[model samples]
Target: MGFIETFGIVFILEAADAMIKAADVELVGYENVASGYISVLVRGDVSACMAAVEAGVRAVENMGAKVYSSIVIPSPHPDLLKITQIYNIDNLLP
Candidate 1:
């Protein structure tokens, strides 16, 4: 779990991961919650996690994926935590 923004700043997902990796971020885990939907789980500060999501979104968009909506999320969401815990994932890079 992490915090990305206190007020509101979005990075798109792909961009956030790229930027975080470039910054040498070592995430504890990353997981996808839904099928055919671009969502993931990672461990870091809320702000950094938010950036990762944005970075992912950017990468998808760069590959020509259409973005319909975007939103900032809270780190403690039960669904997200559940997915991360069940997967036993850790240290996401790229």
Candidate 2:
């Protein structure tokens, strides 16, 4: 699993696109935390997730977006998934 949080709609969209294209990851969920903060979640194999996260960060940085944070979890606990509502299902990109 992977997560990328950044500012600006354009940055988020471009970063998500780069992430999805860079690996076999699937979008799981997204959150708009207000005040121009946005978070995206993706799920896939460990390697793919890592690659996607790297791509997301690079894409956002290249676009001059204020990247807040990012993460890649090889095997997240099922309980954590439940709490975050980040299911294995693919979500449409916004």
Candidate 3:
């Protein structure tokens, strides 16, 4: 990759890392997908981690960086384990 591409990847990755740590979210790991984009995995209470993720997004937004798309919260990895054991029939059955 050229300098610009490398910098963009690093910048996004670093931003994601800093955001997670600053929000007190437990980061599982991350991989740089491309310039200004990365996939992040974090572990913690689902809702709590979500809140933290939201905080992280806000921080990025505060920086006035353009997000290519909306930030996403994945189904599992962090709080999926907890959700499975919640014992909520509404969630389980229908």
Task: List all candidate RMSDs to the true structure.
Answer: 8.1, 4.2, 10.2
Structure candidate 2, residue pairs in collision: none
Instruction: List lDDT for all candidates, in order.
Output: 0.46, 0.81, 0.45
Global lDDT for candidate 1?
Answer: 0.46
TM-score for each candidate, following the candidate numbering: 0.47, 0.85, 0.49
lDDT of 2 by residue, 1-94 (tens): 8899998778888878999999998877678879989888888888998999999999998877778999987767656745575444533221
Winner on TM-score between 1 and 2 is 2
**In model 2, which regions exceed 4 Å deviation?**
86-94
By lDDT, the candidates rank as 2, 1, 3
- Pairing residues by index, what is the TM-score of model 3? 0.49
* Candidate of highest lDDT: 2
Candidate 3's displacement at residue 76, Å, is 2.1
